[model samples]
Target: MSNTKLVINYHITEKCNYDCQFCFAKWENPNEIHAKRGLSEQLIDQLASYYIGSGLQSTKVRLNFAGGEPLMLGKRFIEIVSYAKQQGFELSLITNGHYLTTQFIEQHSHYFSIIGISYDSQDLNTQRKIGRIDRKNNQLTPTELARRIKLIRHISPNTEIKVNTVVNALNWQENFTPLLDVITPKKWKVLKVLPVKNDLLTISNQQFEHFVMAHQSIAAMSAEDNDSMTQSYLMINPQGLFYQNQIHGSDYLYSPPIIEHGVEHCLSQIEFDLNKFANRYIKTINNSHFLTTNTNIEVNHV
Candidate 1:
């Protein structure tokens, strides 16, 4: 039996309205790639069938929508979610929250189990250095961001909220606690900044150290409070076009997996060993050589 949970992360379109400096998706001249609007209902059905036929039929496979901004796909997202539910799959979507409006939230709140929003501040000096937010389109203020988050909660109380923050040289240490103050006591999650090689932004050893320290600190807080209300989640680029692990690296530099026979063709190749992966990604950074050498953790090779 394939015990691995099937998480399908789809990049609907590469075009983004905002030109955030540090956008991992690395939207290069958004004009180059025509924003492919909602996928035809037919392709949606085919995708559904492919997943179901590949033993994802009964599993609580997650459907995640990502992109320049997934919500930008508009009605296609709703259609896909409806179809996924009809097949009994859970749903999730990651967005910049720049396009998030009350009307958009109201229309699709019930369909998703969670909605992830990415926000970095408007301080141009801070934004330009890290390249996380578009200089021009980085219009949403922190107050506006807080308001949008509030509306999402009000519209869909059950839908968990996750905030993806990329910790870089400038804000990794100083801004973390402040960002936490904003997220805690609410449903939110923060992702450590992972680098994509050759992208406009690269992660150096120093930045990595700061990020690891921040993660360790937050992880400890989450442990002590019990009600820490913070969690870490993964969004793998099925195509491997982004990060080696979607959540860790830069979108511009990473290569998404090639889906030839189907999506599982790529999924089956992954070790699917969460512990080992964590040891490699999370532990290796801490310079804790113990876990690195302790390969005794048993996992099915195949």
Candidate 2:
């Protein structure tokens, strides 16, 4: 656990162009903090002060911006991540890749240590069924995805690329090896779709395992079943509150706003298992080919 980095997944906005059925970025609060720059900066300062400035010598903090689509925030998203970088926090972003333009990548890719794109299925019909298509029915094809990855790699060679796939009833049997071989992501995070809103897209445990086993040859591949996902992450919702998913329920438990109640008090309100968090990322840190030369290792990230 000594080498484990503290990851803070800050879901800056719940608004998304594509409405995936299994999407879990629902906070229901219309008053999101990202719209209020002052409040958002205040929250970031609190996080920086406690996690980085508070003399936690053993821990390095990574601020990962996530959302229904963080890229939808456009320039404001870049502004927030830039501020985080300025504060000496390692940064990352998880987006659906619809708005990841080449120009943006060329200019702002340097702000992140990593950029994770959600790519569920290679088949267009499956992607459409999963609601991963945008308003114009435009889906991010594998060719375009690979192009974006190449651009990111060329623009900022040090910025690691990651692909996140949610194994659902629609895409569980699809093999991603062909596309993954082309992009060669630093990591391919395969996750079981949590029935947070509905079980319509959820897949069976056996089906999930089948997908992981099928992709065993990918050196950067990792899988996280629902059990390993629970209480294994430190997440902040769009409202600047600490939130955690219940192991058995669709509902999420949340703390009071971090802007209102400080980081220490707010963290105490949530159920964050340090051991689970460590176990979740330690394996990733160990098996990551981006961090090491070992290509035979496989791990999980919650």
Candidate 3:
């Protein structure tokens, strides 16, 4: 790991308000660690002690709070990130933007280095078809999303904004240039839908390429296909265990709970390719120059 930051994507909860058909946050256990406050804090403490306290001055740990929807945790989510920040870890959050209310951004935006919102389509019908809407038929329209981004910029100017778009059959042909221009995010990640749960929404590599080509003019854009996605991320599930997607199928290979077996022991049970991770990290840094501000950290898995 060439002085790259360790991005531990902790899927704190499997519960989400939206019913996105392509969502891959599913795990075996419905009981997520977030429900158990003490256990959740314990996991955070262990991660901080091992990664931040390991005396590796060359690596910076970015604890990205992901979820079925992290913002749904509301005040509890704020407390978790606050604790992680105190432990010397850089914080980021990937939310669906449904619960990314003005109150939260105005009050807690300072807690994050980056805030990623999943915005797949600008068309309300497309969004509804993709299950990106809540039970009440509520969705984050482009106007609303742009409004939120403006608020973030005004309140937390230093905090980088990110937009995550999953390229699936439903929205691959749609042009996002107008939307991207309006939001003006620091980074716009276009990810090919993975077939972890089902291939119903998966698009061909060629189709995915078309979407990327159409938006090639976007300066802050990056695209990731399935091949580049697998075995590259350091993921921890809601059960407090290190896990990776199986190379061959939809199945996942999990380690013993990190809280119980220790980080080293748990990591040993999974196959994490350092080379792949380095490539992804380097690409991310290249795409977003703002990440270079803090680069003196040691190598640790996220």
The number of the candidate with the highest TM-score is 2
lDDT value for model 1: 0.51
lDDT of 1 by residue, 106-177 (tens): 888778887877664445466555544554636556667778777877888888776666544466555555
Clashing pairs in 3: 8-302, 58-297, 58-298, 59-297, 59-298
How well is each residue in 75-159 modelled by candidate 3, as lDDT tens digits? 7878888888988889999999998888998999989999999999999999999999998989999999999989999999999
Q: How do the candidates rank by TM-score, highest first?
A: 2, 3, 1
Candidate 2 pairs with clashing backbones: none
Top model number, lDDT: 2
CA shift at 74, candidate 1, in angstroms?
2.2
TM-score of each: 0.65, 0.93, 0.92
Off by over 4 Å in 2: 57-59, 283-302
Q: Which stretches of candidate 1 lie over 4 Å from their true place?
A: 1-5, 26-58, 122-124, 128-138, 185-193, 197-199, 211-260, 264-302
- RMSD, each candidate, Å? 8.1, 4.2, 6.0
lDDT of 2 by residue, 1-302 (tens): 56789899999999899989889897778998889867888899999999888886434889999998988888788888878888889999999999889888988888899999999999999999999998899899999999999999999999999999999999988989899899999888888898886788887777777787788788888677787788999999999999999977789999998988899999999899888777666543446321111234333322
lDDT of each: 0.51, 0.85, 0.84
Task: Please report the TM-score between candidate 1 and the true structure.
Answer: 0.65
- Candidate 2 RMSD to the real structure: 4.2
